[model samples]
Target: MFIGGLGRSGTTLLERLLGEVPGVAPLGEVVHLWERGVIGKEPCGCGEPFTTCPFWRRVGIRAFGGWSTGLADRILTLRRRVDRTRHIPALAARRCRVGLSGYTRAYSRVYEAAAQVAGGRVVVDSSKHASLAFCLRTSPVVDMSVVHVVRDPRAVAYSWRKQITRPEDGTPMTRWPSAWTAVHWLVQNLAFELLARRGGTVIRVRYEDLLADPPAVMQALLTRLGLGGVAVTFLRQGVAELSVAHTCAGNPMRFAAGPLDLSRDDNWCDRQPRLHRWLVTALTWPLMLQYGYRPRDRRTPEGAVAPWLTAGVAAQECR
Candidate 1:
């Protein structure tokens, strides 16, 4: 049961919790062939390095032609050579689709090989990308179960702004103006919404509820995936330490490494900049309303029907 979604949408938390479960192998973001030069890295908190890691090593054994580690590095170089200065959406789409095809081929080969190595029925990959999700679903080798994880739009924009501003001299992305950011939030969410509805076992998970009560949320997910009851013991242990990788080489992000941490809910209220809160709300307002988020603008918040409150959340009271 692969847990897929947008970045920073609690995939790591889910991976960690599920990793603790017996009989389930959790390799967070093993996007091995997507970009290259990843294997020689240090142990990701999951207790293994890319090169020496049993997971990838086994995956390497079965991959048809034994693709080199340098494959990802080469792809990165080619991507950098592309010119995308004007930010034209049509051009961007055309260029991205062209490049995406190669990556998809490599990804499919690597995962198919890795699946053989793991010897487990399911491999959880939290490398969330709508395009990749689309490709994987269509691939003959993959029988993917996509988990469309979502959070408030304001929260997403807030986090994006934080990461974009951090110390990165190379490949820095321009910050989206609030309106543009909202538009992006809607677009990405809409993509997932459409995919989920077209559905064959697509699950939508909310970051808020997942953080608020992980064990219960996880149990429901495992049941839905038909993962049996083996995950229960892992849930009782609280959290597990796991390794993770980013889309770029040498740019790994750990689960507990930074400010917009997922170990808790309401991270937005705590870590978000004052300005981002408004932008987040504006962009994600419709979604927030749709997903049962209480609308602050209304006298009676959205979804506030009497007896609507579950006993567990009743003490918190309605907004």
Candidate 2:
């Protein structure tokens, strides 16, 4: 029961929701174990420092073989040397095969480790990345059910702009580059598109709809996973409490909840300028509209805001 989507695409929110259901263990971003050895003192949103967390300690013992505590300590120590900025492209280029073999091995390690300790056939991983998803679909170790979460691009960019701003940097945040955001969203969602075409269990979830009506959304999600009738316990925590902002690299699963903040839906209108609006629309209009976003021209005057991409794309730009 792995749950994933783009960074900042509500992966954390979804994991916590699913975790509340009995029999489901939603581990935020156990991605550390597979990240080719980069870690941080950043505590997991699971409410434990990674190395000291009971959950990860068990995972370490079962997956790597040895004292869980010792393995966790080693991971934290090795993690210190990691250069966050370059790890992804470097590892994806160097270790990930265009084929499925390498991916299966990597995913197997993580899944087996989780299952061994958690004692569940399904695992929830909110570390959304399309490339990784594609690799897992073809891997022998995992039978993945992908939920590609979509959100409005404007809201996503707005959220990202806020998140990236730093008091020390003293630089105002700007809209994410449209071309970059557009291509990234396209490729990642397209990964799911291709996978669905290949004939497998894949679901597309809209974040807007999920938040708007959680019970229905969650029920449908569990049914798809063949785990039905689970109690839906939605946590109401603040955003920072849930944020993995201080965690290793960054895990979207670390978000705090609050009263329904639908303001996030159209936040880009307030954040992006006229030019960025034009650029984002021109580059992403076709894809954006495909997943429930309406162009400004089609919207009512009151809704005459800029066009938005799907929630998935929107969240990426923001994150």
Candidate 3:
């Protein structure tokens, strides 16, 4: 399964919760693994360098006959060539398949290898990039389902301005200004909506709903995916039981394990700059309302119905 959303939109949190599900294997962000995990030798979720981690080592061997600086470099170059947000338009045309063959094959190999390494558990890739999602759509070998997670634009914009540190490397995580985030947020979400209109199973979920009632959200997802037998015992009483897995690059929270407090992080309401919030809402008003986010009600009242297409969500979970 692929989790699609903008950065800092709770994709990591959803993936971590899904990791605890039986018959599921979480691969943090394979879209970044070629560079961050393989070339840069960043820490995996297990807290070991990807080159030294047994899980990734096996994946490399299975995927490409073993890891080497040369192979990593080659794939990284291919990734940049074919996988990019701007390339989504061409990829959607589906006529670029011939040119994208190399990366498509490489990507399929990574998931295949991961599935093999994880004893055939379903691989959950929380890459959270609309461009990457479209790239994967071109691959015949990858059977992907999308969990399109949406959050309030104001909250998402506020998140982009905060300083965060990467747990994988000692470097700081990427941060974007509110305007930049607003534009990308609109584009990314629209891309996913376009993707659903084209093909494949795409289930939409509000990030607020997921944070508020993880058990219900996760159970609804599993049941929709026909994995109704899997128990979501890991989430209960507003806490999530996280386990170490070989996730690649993601939010620093990916490094966290054991019991984690699943409180709603709504720091944006009061802390965000009024100018930034207004700009974000103005830039994204039309689609924002389509997603059920109120333009005036920037402050999502505590315990109120999550601002989203709840009926659309219910239809998806049932289907």
Candidate 4:
């Protein structure tokens, strides 16, 4: 299954939670697998850098005969040309052209190899890019299902505005303005919706709802993906057990060991500037309402009702 959404919308956390299930292998962000993980030699979830990790070494051998920096760089270049918000419409329309099919086949090899190494029936890829998700959906090498993860735009904007350090490298990641982040939230969500309508098997999940009830949300998600028999265990309240996931690249949080706390990050509600909060809400209003996020004045005591829950959409599980 592919986890598609805007970054920082809880894709990493969801990947970790899903990875806990017996037959699921969470490959952090395979969009970055060739570039950041392989070429840049960034650290894998296993602590060792990607090129040095035994699991990745095995995957490299299986997928590409051997991992080569030159080959990785070429693939990264091809990925850059095809995977973009502007190219999403062409991809969804199934407009086959030069370079598109090659990228898809190359990308599919990573997931196919991951499944081989993980020994799992399902591989969870939290790539979080709509264009890439569409590409995977079109690929013949792997059967892909998409989980479109959405968070409140206000919360997402606030998270993007804050300074965050990559846990793997201790490098400070860049932050975008509230306005830009809001626009991204809108476009990315719409793109995923468009892809779903174009025959991709997609199920949307709200980050807040997932945090409120992980097992229940996951049960609904797994059921929709037709893996209803898979078991997911939470070690305690708000904590999930994590194994050694050989994910290529993602939030540094993927490197965290032991049980993970599955709590919601609502710091934006209390700390975001008034102007920024209003801006995000105004820009995201229509789609927000469609997804069960009400205007501040109209919010219910129980908070937002996910679209899947209230609209009788596919994979309804929120309560």
Candidate 5:
């Protein structure tokens, strides 16, 4: 299963929760496997550096004969060139260049190896990139399903505007302007919706709903994935069982050890600047409505509801 969404939208938390299920391996952000895991040698969920992780070492050998900086660079370059929103049209047309095909094969190998290592049937990738999900959907070797995660745009904007330090590395996470964050949240979610309509199964999960009831939400998701009978071992509130996972790259939260409290981070709803909140809600109003988010009570100059847009027009504008 591919987890596609904007960063800081609880993809890491969801991945950690899902990883607790039997016969499932949650590989955090495999899209960055090449650059961060192989080249930069970041720490794995296993606490060892990515290069030295026994599980990843086996996966490396299986996926690429052995990982190398040169191979990592090549993969990263290929990804940058083709795996992007602007390149979606060509990819959708099945314009499979050699590099693109090679990358698909390599990625499939990584997933296959991960499944083998975990002794599991399902390989979960929380890449959170719509383009990567699109690319994987086109791969002959991959039968991809997507869980499109979304949080309130205001929350997403607030999260992006903060300067959080990575737990694996003390480097500060990149922050974005509230406007850009809102724009990206709108475009990326729309893109995932369009891609989902094209092929394969896609399920939308709201961050709030998931946090509200993780067990029910997770069970429903696993059922949709045809794993209804698989024992779900992690569901208790304020407790999540974790195991060593060969995740490639993701938020520093991936490195967190032991049981984790499944709590909501709705602090943004209260602490976010009113202007930023208003801006995100306005920019993402139509899509937010589609996703069941309520509009603010504020009115426009014309005494009409603020930021109103017809759903049809919103879909068209997104396209």
Candidate 6:
């Protein structure tokens, strides 16, 4: 499973939850493994530095005959050429299969290795980048399913404005202005919707709904993913017992484990500034309403999205 969405929309939490499933292994964010995991040697979710984690050590040997500066740099270069948002148009049209193949081979090796190391549990990658998701769609080696997570745009904007820390390297998390995050939120979610329309096992999951009923949402998710018989041992009545994961690069929350409260946090409703909230609603109202989010004001500007496109995403969500 490839869980894709904007960064702060609970993708990490979702992965950790899914990892507790009997036949699942959550990989934090393989998209950043070259830089954050291999080159920089950040802490893996297991509390070992990536280079020392036995799982990752085995993954390196299995995936690329051992991770090296040359391998990391080569894959990073391939990523630059093939995985940017600007390349999405060509990727979606299947016009860049040749360009994507090399990257896809290297990328699939990571998942393939992790699955073998985890005793063949289904691997879950919470990369959360639509462009990377598009690239993976063409992989001959991966049978990928996507859970496109969406949170309220206002809440997501608030998250981007905060000052958080990256625990592994003691660096501050990146911050963005509400307007920039709003636009990013718009584009990122749109890209996933485009992925849905293009076809695959794509499911839309609202952050709010997941919080409301953890076990039900999780079980339904597995069923949708065609793993319905897997025992739902992780989530229990809005609480969970999280196990250590080996996710690569993601929010610092990746390190957290044990009992977790799946609570509904509406801090943004009271704390986000009024103007920024309005700005996000204005920019994302069309897609917002499609996902059952009601903007403060429901007047969508003319031509914000083609009518057919709107209908297309909604139809795709049901599939």
Candidate with the greatest lDDT versus the true structure: 3
lDDT for every model? 0.53, 0.53, 0.83, 0.81, 0.78, 0.82
Per-residue lDDT of 1-319 in model 4, one digit per residue for the tens?
8898998899998898888888888988988888788778998999899999999999889999989988888888888788777888888888855687888888778788888987988898899999888777667777888888988888888889889898766889879999999999999999988987787777888888787767667776776777776667654677887777888888878887787887778788788888998998999999988776776943222334444633222433321
Ten-residue region with minimum lDDT total, candidate 5: 305-314
Which candidate achieves the best TM-score against the true structure? 3
Clashes of each: 5, 20, 1, 0, 0, 1
Could you tell me the TM-score of candidate 5? 0.90
Candidate 6, residue 85: lDDT: 88
Please give the distance, in angstroms, between residue 91's alpha carbon in candidate 6 and its true position after superposition: 0.8
TM-score of 4: 0.93
Output the worst ten-in-a-row residue range by lDDT, candidate 6. 300-309
What is every candidate's alpha-carbon RMSD to the true fold?
7.2, 7.7, 2.2, 2.6, 6.3, 5.2
The lowest-lDDT stretch of 10 consecutive residues in candidate 1 is: 310-319
lDDT of 2 by residue, 1-319 (tens): 5455545566666676666666666665555543422244445554456566676666656765633444445444433333122233433344443434643454567677776677777777765765555555556668777767766655554455454542222345444555566556666666556556666466776676666555656676776667866655543321211222222223433433333332234556655766756665676678777775765732213322212223222222211
Better of 3 and 4 by lDDT: 3
TM-score for every candidate vs. truth?
Answer: 0.69, 0.70, 0.94, 0.93, 0.90, 0.92
Name the runs in model 4 displaced over 4 angstroms. 297-319
After superposition, candidate 1 runs with Cα above 4 Å error: 30-33, 36-49, 73-105, 163-181, 237-267, 270-275, 297-319
**Full candidate order by TM-score, most accurate first:** 3, 4, 6, 5, 2, 1
Question: Cα deviation in Å at residue 139, candidate 4?
Answer: 1.5
Q: Write the per-residue lDDT of candidate 5 for residues 1-319, one digit (tens) a residue.
A: 8888898888888888788888889888898888888888998888889999998999888877899999988888888777888877676666755578777878899999889888999899999888887788778889888888888788889899889998777889899999999999998998888886676567777777677666666766776677776656666655677666667788877877677787778777678888888888889999988876776733111212111122111122121
Cα lDDT for residue 32, candidate 3:
84
